[model samples]
Target: MTRKIFKQFFLALVALLSVTFALTTLATADTSNLAAENVDITFGTTVDADLPAGSLLKLNQPAGAIYPLHNSTGKLLSRGIAGDASTAPSLTTDQIKLDVQSGNVYYQVLPDCWLQSDSTVTLLDSTGQAPTDPVALTLKFVDANGKEIQDAKTFDAQFSTTTDATTLATLETELLAIRPAVTGYNLVSADQAEHVITYHYAKPTISTGSTTVATQPSDPVTTTTPIPAKTEPVAVKGTAIYATKKIGLYTSPNFSKATRKIWYQKKQRQNRPQFVVIGYAKSRSGQLRYKIRDINHHSLTNNRRGYITANATYVTSLYYHQNPKKIQVISGHGLNAYQAVTLHGRKLHHYRKGATLEVKAVKTHGLTTRLVLSNGHYITANKTMVIKR
Candidate 1:
């Protein structure tokens, strides 16, 4: 009986010890998690780091320990903050955002991290210490004719952690102050975007007619001028002429008669005036000109009949000049073959890049130009979208 009681007591002690060990392990795990959550993470200022221009910077953690970075989906981006002075993580990016309320800056610095800023980080100078490599901002000068006036100019534009509208506007103002002036051209509009700055200039029209016309019909001429034989005007049917750029609209075939009534602007490719050709007239100067009537509905020059240059440089046939058996799509995002020439209607099909399509004919309308496929559907004839095979 004594041995039995001793064994039972021993069994009870063993059970108590097992339960205590389990409870201690659970408590320790909970405490460890709490400590991790309470770790004092801090980001130092630029003064604490040795940052080399155009090189990777090594940030010193003098006050707090660095922690792993995570993305929005809770995916780990970095094991910890980078310590290398010569090489950062290959995935580290310069894209960053600034928190105004906390006066802290947040960086991606990792491929997957969507980091948020806290009070630990500080703001750097707006003009100094760019977060990323400088972006190439292109400045293009274009005339009213939609042609480049000169070679495009480019400059490096740097940004801080965040860019707001006011900051962008200020930068634009500073950049515009350096615009080069062109003779006989007045700046009409300056369009500004993040990476592109376009300045459109207009040149005032000057009379090209000679003022030396005979005041008296009986006045003796210095030399006799030979008159050329009369040429019959050629009739055109079902064709149109489009101004490749801005061209003058004349009331008569002869430019010496008067100055252009109006300058037809080619602001939008799809909405430009489409002049329906009726016939071709030879000017007194021996240049052939297109007798056209503007059929662009709702345009300022709509229904206005006039003469335009026949030079292929300034004007082009509304339809494709040559017929091709096949064409290939060149646009990266793929071109949408529409039901009609207009972009307002439903998309018939989408032709991906390098997609070869059979062509039936090329057609044009007031809205835009399109390629009529063999399947009776229309796709864009935009040179940027497709190419003849």
Candidate 2:
């Protein structure tokens, strides 16, 4: 019996040690997985240039890709215009461009500077003046083998008369003497920036130069890094009310002479606010204005959306009305869509006196309590129009 017990204990001890070794090996295993071990890059102000983990980058548009330019007011500045088609400067479809775009801050070349002219390319307003000569941009790079790259990249603002740069990488020129365009950034003053590009290569990979495999100690382990997701747009919150002792609507935020009259005059000073504010903007003079509307009513003015002077109106936090409930139109006829809750107002649609419309909410303006519809049009909640179902 003693001998049998000793044998069983010895076997159990070996099993335990094997399990312990397996667990220890798993605990020390490397999780980082990297494939481009021999590729690297660096750039920007004096910092070492290396691509952020888990990003792919490509430079320059493929040949045969054409892009058009536009003027400030948004007119196409085509290639064939006002003579100088053969001599006027323009970027070819194959012009070299560099854009550093990993995530949201995508550096893209814009055509904001180029202008249209009858004779020559003009300067962009952003660039005070355009230069006659093509700008000079510096470019440097090294391959994966750590060797200087020659003729791999080149750039020019315009054709040089003193030297021949026709065979170079980029040929950029102004449109009718205007500051020309660059990718991912704007020109300084009225001239193009002498952008400096430098590239750093990675260490070369070791090779046996033979078909047969060479013995290696072990493969290095690596972990995979996940890319972050992009963010979505959120809707604006809060509500704006248009109410006061007296109200006058204007064509613009400046309260310009062009007026959009919505009558809401109360004899007594009361906080009877109407209209929900939807948007905010500034006029040319920079006065603040709010986009408010008595939704479901006939919109004020000649337009469907109306704006009011925020400072002159009583602005308040959003107040939720009762949830939409179904109701029947038990009486009345001829309910015209008024631009507002008032009985005397602009007409939107002339409908028969009795029609079943969902009442989304109830809003009060002075003595009138209007039934708000899902589409933001309002109808009077008077006995002549609706009754409880």
Candidate 3:
């Protein structure tokens, strides 16, 4: 009877000890799922370290269901669907799809969506510093489809020391990086459970294409050419009084028939008085005397040397005659013969219907009273016109 009693007591003690050990093991184990009901998604400036083992933190998204994140410089980091929790938060995947769809797994980091390692983001206090505890971290959530949800779709969750800070920081950084690119989504809420924090991101607006890209420039320089100058006019002078029917030079004292000629010669760099009747010529071989034409300086056909009388007329007037009293038709019409006289400073070269006198004064008479054909003409003192020589 003593042995039996001892065995029964020992057995009961063993059972009790086993039960106690089992209870302690159960209590000490990570019961993250146990406080799921008590876990309230709240926004605080800092996270508390003394939450229950199984406690869960939740986040309430903004009504618009979109969350935007920006750097201190206001540059866009990333954008995608937010608050829909079911999709992986990735630059390549759509975050909004996971929220509405079943069997979707959440991803902490997406390729190409995270900030460059050298960049830093600070979770500030209301004063913009890292708060010690119960600090609210604004998390920008994106779905698998990369659409931005409304602000009401955001999440806010409290974190404690019992919660993993490394994991929380990583999540926070990702959310911050992505928020700036969130076009149609808003932040709903965030929940924390032990070492894991879940973000509920929602979409308020839908978008199709990606953001705009920029362009760059090239290298090397360029150049161009310049222009040239213009040509000047030449001067001409002479004493020969050659005339066409329109332009005539006659004797000074007597106004009578003298000589009728065509061709006239001119020299270069000579300053003759303006409107002084000099020579006569024609525009063509058979044409009658017209007027004194233009005087050209150089001649290309004459081996580029200067030449006169190259252009002449059929009928030209000659005023300088050896015997002025005798009438002579050197070229054309005798009735058209006349004389040029200088009275005072003014010159009267055209004669009246009937005037006869002697050639008492002959001024600078060079060429004989001969008729020569030319290609140009000139103007008379009477204001009669001539063609070009």
Question: Candidates' lDDT values, in order?
Answer: 0.49, 0.36, 0.26
Q: Tell me which of candidates 1 and 2 scores higher on TM-score.
A: 1
TM-score of 2: 0.22
- What does candidate 1's lDDT look like per residue over 94-174, in tens digits? 223221111222333333332334333322333434255435557687987779976776643333324333333333432
Tens-digit lDDT string for candidate 3 (118-169): 1121122222223355434443244535343423223333333334353344
Model 1 segments beyond 4 Å from truth? 1-235, 257-259, 266-272, 324-389
- Each candidate structure's TM-score, on Cα atoms with residue i matched to residue i, is 0.30, 0.22, 0.14
Candidate 1 least-lDDT 10 residues: 32-41
Off by over 4 Å in 3: 1-236, 240-318, 326-342, 345-351, 365-389
Error of 1 at 386 (Å): 6.3
Residue 261 deviation, candidate 1, in Å?
A: 0.9
Could you tell me the lDDT of residue 260 within candidate 3?
A: 29
